[model samples]
Target: MEVTDVNNVKIYNLSCGKTFPDWLPDRKKRQLLKKEPSLKRRIELIQDFEMPQLCNTINLSSNGEYIFACGVYKPTMRCYDLNNLSMKFERCFDSEIIKCKPLSDDYTKLVFMFCDRYVEFHSQSGRYYRLRIPKFGRDLDYHPPNCDLFFVGDTSDIIRLNLEKGQFLNPYQGSSTSFNCCKVNPFHHLLVCGSTDGQVEAWDPRIRERVGSLDCALSALTVDPQGIPAIRSIAFKDGVNLAVGTETGLVLLYDLRANKPYYTKDHMYGLPIKSVVFHQEWVISMDSKVVKIWDRETGKPFTSVQSQYDLNDLCLVPETGMFFLACENQKIQSFFIPSMGPAPKWCSFLDSIVEELEEDQDDAIYDDYKFVTTKDLEEIGLNHLIGTNLLRSYMHGFFIDHRLYNKAKATSNPFAYERYKKKKIAEAMEAASGDRVKLQPKLPKVNQELAKKLYDLELSGDGSRKAKQTVALLKDERFKSLFENEDFQIEQDD
Candidate 1:
């Protein structure tokens, strides 16, 4: 997918036809519909509120059933009930509501912080309480499975609050960098916090001291499966890993036990990630109107949302598999995650090859290759190489070059490569033992019809002359004759 700016608005250009699986019988859906009418794609405008005040920060409740938004000029917090998309305007003494969370069983009760210095709790029973502490707070996380408490932190210290008793415990002391994010381990008493100065500090609230520390922060923080701060925004099959969003719009996931990140993607957006969240399966982040949801395991974004304003906060409500998005424009939107059905059954042969390629690439400095499926190669006239021993040699050479080689991974259910493997071994043994090494045969040359069609593209009196340069890239070398006229001209039935 590519984003291009025309005039002042950004237009998303999707290259849906450019895919690796070109061989399946019914796979070329987009290409088959070439002459069909174009479809207009528009973002769903769920709801909008014109708040001239303009908000800079937003937060959602733990369960994602309520929205809390605040801006610089606004003196009070705005609360929106998600039960029926209703809203209530409430006044507050706090200068700014920077963070908020649900404190009790009833969704009506809430706890929000003002200027990171004061914590205010408004109970459903019409009672309110405020607590002032020495350090400021950045993020609030409520812990459930282990302790009946919540955690918040500033630059140098973290505060643990017992919500049931409405009390604050001794502050957990740590580094001096301001904390940018924090999360509680639901299965343990550990509290993890990431600092603006690139430090991750982990502490057990019961011990009231620091237990572990790592470097790198300013993105999202989460505990891994071992209940360690090894990963960030994404979850893995064995453990939770950290998905670090840098200022350059690159997303990376680091395993806690490893010193380096496992995967990295330059998402190419120019906005800083304000908040990142992960469900059991996906990682979600904010980037203007497009809320990108990436598969935690694959590091690929499968879906996104298009909007007019930047998304400041996002949360996944696991009970319903629905997502709540709180925009900087003070409007909250919720959408159901399209059911992806079940995990598609994969051919073990292809799956193994793909995994091997990924691992080899990660461990070595090989070039990246764009591989096409057997069907695609066949259409381009390269199919005979599939089962030849020469092909295995070619794959070995490809591995030596460290390029991607998952061509047959998604095809033919069982991905039967045994036939091809035997052929390749025979050819390789014959060649390796000093017999003549026959180079792979080339495909039939490009036809005159296709060349003329390409040439017409050059002189069609349209703005496609630039396209002609790429037509030269057609795989069939024999097609070049169509360009005989060098400077072809149009003739009106002459």
Candidate 2:
């Protein structure tokens, strides 16, 4: 549905199901219950300074206060302030910092990993040391036990490393598989690892042997909220439940203790479930490109948002309710969980559709047209349908009062008349606007940015004044030199 923002009038395109569901009350009743949040919150673009020589991957600190962005090129590490959205500091590393995690107690100590499977221990003060592992490292996590070691998961094996000793030990060598993710158990000596083969296996680093194993089968697995490894990446909240994100973007929260899943919510599309986290109140998942949050206890889907890019790494910052979305492009996007006070406007729309469908006793007649609505045409908007002249038949249809097979003869260019109508309307509007707009002396365009800026300023309330100022400014030899620059030129053909 196309929802217009009364503030700015910019409309957003949304799917029908998104704004309307099959279980809600009538539209009037739904509208009375809640109002749509206005489109006042446009995306504010932050200027990126201290540009990396080459961008790779990005991660945020556990507290969401700092961002650690790394690039494949030299000068690998760059740190930015999450609050102000600006680069606060930067450091050049020997190689790209593929991943970084800060110790809970000491913010100075950071575990940095590189693409070459090399890891380094560095202090915020610039002192650093490296740990060497034979197998290439794919992902790693710190083992919180008193053993003072970090567990590193690679494509084929799991390894244990003592950061202080720079020593490494492989707990699982031959069982090596395409490992994807891993976590250290809270109360046990077992380290859980997930693989592409859909297996979640536990290994006792002390004995260097496998203890428990479960087939997650393309399921992003995590130890359940109850601290058990029943499935991969699926977790529990109240001691008997399980929450899992599947490869098909179906997030399931089950009550294993009850031998049943509490509920399941399919993401709008099929996206490879990348990660899942069970907070005390929410079951969150990173699937394909969206961050999905659901109710932990009820298993009801709450809300979802695309993280602005393909998310490769993700984690939630405890206590603050903030989350970090890390992209392979070396940019980390941090977002805060908005309070669950008023639901989105689309929620109300869905509720209305559902209620109407239930109230209709003769639902079969309208079953095929259930998806149809006036909002559909408005949502597609004039811009997208402008160039494509098929809107008449595709976006609308003519009704016939005749019986049986009475029909309008199909025309090759059914929307041709509609296209002409719209074109004439646009030309009339353009001509009306041209009456007051005075043409300016064209200058060679120096750059797109400058051209756009000048256009915008001239289009502002004081176009004549701005035009005169531009003409005077262009008379300067320095300004004329800009036109001669290799970057600037306006085609005379126009």
Candidate 3:
């Protein structure tokens, strides 16, 4: 127990862990084991706000008061008030908004980098100023230290613009032609850019050329069929440590003092790593597949979360474990990972909420339920199990109460679905039964012309063949059944 003598006050915190057995039988010694074998990462869903379209990027204001989500459907952008957790307003654009950054401390002053060769400055009222670049802007960054706007894109150089004098400053020549991501390190005040040619280049404004780690982060990709890898995201833990994410699902940590990387980690999904950031003691990375939080020292995954849809980007909520994720579902998802850290000061109430969640027992949404489709019943031989305790029907599927999915899959025929399909085709070929539902069961498709001709022959219509066609069809045994069968004959009434 920890005690604080603030003013000769003896206050006890019952929440602190005690060395006594509370949940055990009295007078008996039983080692209190962990309720779970692994870390119980209770990542709660905090927000699922709707967006205009696919949220290509997400950014928060310098004060963490507002969030901006933009995408390419109509080249639209939506702003949300973080304090109230409600959307403030939406603004549409002519060009695709690929990147966004806050020029000033608040959301009122914002600059957007378009897919075309344009950069637009916007305020709460409307557009304030506009600037044109030589090449299409891929990413944007703002350096408060120099009060300059950094733009990287299709060209082989980084553009520096002065906001005070409204003029373009000198550019930093890079090793690659196209740059994808740009950032300014808070500790070193160095400008870093991730390029399309898989190089993470850093620059000092005072120098004409690059200064920091000019190494390729995609050097470890050895898969034969995989193509070239490009750097997609870059994050800074400190001035010395840099985390680089590539399009080929690789993350490299580089120490600025050396040319070599400290270590390299792969996401294993073979997808483009969308975002990678350092939070507390963990390195969080998100791909198109899943979000992974791993240890900074051991490089082992702490926990993972599978996104509901393909992810486009991720932004770490400032000074908190909560994060906002942008995806194609026209909605942004935010999850609070308790292990990352506690809630921020603005929302300290979440700490008790998390504690309550830890002690609370959660029931499955579908308890003892298994979802089985129409094909699953036939393939898994669950017809007999439906009415019994083994299976229960719900919605459009069956739930297994007695047998597990693995056991059923092991017992049922793996080729049952194929056999069932063949049997269905054979039944369809044979005319449907008379008692078949009045709605008319579907039959195998045949030539409409041939069916019409057969019907004409049955009725002795004008189209009935008189010589060669009649003789040829009559000799075929297949036609004999069609002509003689009462089911095939068209009858208007009884």
Q: lDDT scores for all predictions?
A: 0.52, 0.53, 0.72
Count steric clashes of candidate 1.
14
Candidate that would win on TM-score = 3
Q: 1-494 in candidate 2: lDDT tens per residue? A: 23323222222223111223336569754684366443222222223522344344555565556666666556467776656656776777776565576655434667777767677777877747776667666566776553445444555656667655556654565254556566665555456666656555666767767876654442323322222222224443434444555555666665433433456666656665667777667777876477777777675666665644566656565544445565544334544442422212213333343345447635554333313223443333322343344332324442112221112211334665675676677678768898686776465646545655565554442325546687455456777656567655555566
Count clashing residue pairs in model 2.
21
Instruction: Report clashes for each candidate as comma-separated counts.
Output: 14, 21, 0
TM-scores of the candidates are 0.50, 0.50, 0.63
Which structure is stronger by lDDT: 1 or 3?
Answer: 3
- Residue 364 error, candidate 1, Å: 50
Give the Cα error of residue 169 in candidate 2, in Å. 2.9
| Candidate 2 wrong stretches, greater than 4 Å | 1-65, 71-75, 81-86, 104-106, 147-156, 173-176, 186-190, 204-209, 218-268, 328-332, 340-494
**Ten contiguous residues minimizing lDDT sum, candidate 2:** 398-407
The lDDT ranking, best first, is 3, 2, 1
